[model samples]
Target: MILEEKKKKDEKNEKLQTDLCECYLLLNMWISSELLSICVPCLLKAASKKEESEDTRKEVEMALLALCNLRFIKIEQELYLNEIKEIIQHHQEYHNLTRLAYQSAWRFLVSRLWDDNSLEKVIVVEQHFAREAARELEELSKSVDWKKNKKGGERKEKEEMITTLRWMQTLSFFFGNCYLWNEEYVELFSSIVGVLRASRDNYREISEKCIYPFEEASGRRVVKIGSLWQSGAVDVALEEIHKSAKDDEIAAKILKFFMNVSRRLKEKKKDEIEEMKRKELKRKIFEKMEEEGYEDVVTSFHKTFDFLSNKYFFDDALSLDIFDYLVNV
Candidate 1:
């Protein structure tokens, strides 16, 4: 009887489901924090609806993306533990919802980590939240089909693995800086490294989002002992991506990764041994690029008219992602 009732409920709401909103528009437009303050609550209320039906679920998903887009503004308040719990319990509404949870966590945590008082607050709940995320991630990674469509009304569209990995990468940055890096679930880090290493086509995002955040989070030592890039997996992926990628988006991500790494090495201090190692790695990368005939990747990146005008020269419709990269890269 319960199963039938659940099915009927799901069926009734399925048709009311809406498509994911163009949250990217928030990225492409000029908006102020004051204006965002007005819109954020509406999105959150939509995200916080009581029902787990498809329509409500999509609303939550869209709101989360919109929140991530406006991440520049300091979050006015911390989310309740119950709401954070629902983010991990996203499987009840949809599959990719768990990933959206990671993004929300990233956006929320990052806003606070830079400030003294807010960082104090993060330290208080840091271990508890990290452990909860690890447990949920352990369950989610069990059947990670990056290409498969989500269940129910989302069957037509494949899972948004790229965005999900970006979120995880941001989470990794937070974890890298927190006590969790030194003392929490080692297995969870291993799983993330494994999945990221296995990725092929979307490796550009991995390089920019995943590896870069890990670098930012760690101070003296970049990645921990079992860190993904330390395993040489990131280098291998970059070689493959540089060799085969033709799309402008992929090129942009790759170029941005290279740009960022060069800048980090130049500005940061490191121990003698790690310094030698990084220089050697950089030399090898350039050598390989020359061999593969992608020596002109950056030159080509600069030459791309749309990106040049939109991002570099005009900087009008610039994205936050690109802004962050250019500042650090």
Candidate 2:
């Protein structure tokens, strides 16, 4: 009946997907500029194919591997770059493919970003990646295997977590370089704070991986009542500051977060309700920093890094004046 016919059709599709993967791998051994240019469009089509079955997933991975092996200059046009960005931005693809395949595709896309210094491209890619990374972060926090993997449980789950951390570093790079809109910051901030509070042993990893974006968001007017200060983002960050005080980088990032939060306190010309909200947020953050002994932490870094000097050798000192005018605000 119809069930038997559908099964036969699935079998045939699986076989064709497997054969195409084999052919793509074989062709990768003899990659050339002209051959790659001709093959890349088709490869992109395959790599972005919606994940319907295990066979289709493998075919997409193979196509990505083939694309990775090929020369970038041969197919670095807007069409191909957009195709690759679309692949990276597709949140469902993260769940469908193995960690290896997903990592390879992302690395390939980043390689292109580093080579091109176009601000427009960087901004566009950052927005897309930020949304996807936020979704992945929320998903990771809820995953059962992620909880087990934290306790040295499963190899595959551990690798997946590592991949997620690396992606966070990539996000930090984006936030450090470009400015994201308010909506993007709200979503990313909510997810990052949730993950940090939920984390157990990997606290430093979470702080180190996410500090830049947190810093970026704190510098902006991200004072949405429920998502920002009210959600305990500043509290979790201060708690981490005490927990990670021994690590200078994480501590410095936490101080920068406070500095940025304070900088927003100087904003003017807001409506009555908005001004009241900002005042309350500033009061809570300053109070928490005092309770957590942040002055000792900031003074410690200043003494070590010589933040008092007018002329310092490292530009990192310039960024971490710790007590400087919090921002342009």
Q: Candidate 2, residues 1-329: lDDT per residue as tens digits?
A: 22232247435454344345446545555555544454566667777887669888887877776665542343456547777767766734456665546655764554444445463344444535556567767876776242434355634435556656765665555554443344555576778777766654543465456665575556545334335566567767767766664435666566656666665576653599977776766666666677777667666666544433233233234444556623221
- Give the TM-scores of the predictions, in the order they appear: 0.48, 0.63
Error of 1 at 138 (Å): 4.9
Give the whole-model CA lDDT for all candidates, comma-separated: 0.46, 0.57
Cα misplacement distance, residue 54 of candidate 2 (Å): 2.5
Superposing all C-alpha atoms, what RMSD in Å does each candidate have to the true structure? 10.8, 9.0
Tell me the RMSD of model 1 versus the true structure. Answer: 10.8
> Candidate 2, after superposition: displacement of residue 272 in Å?
6.0
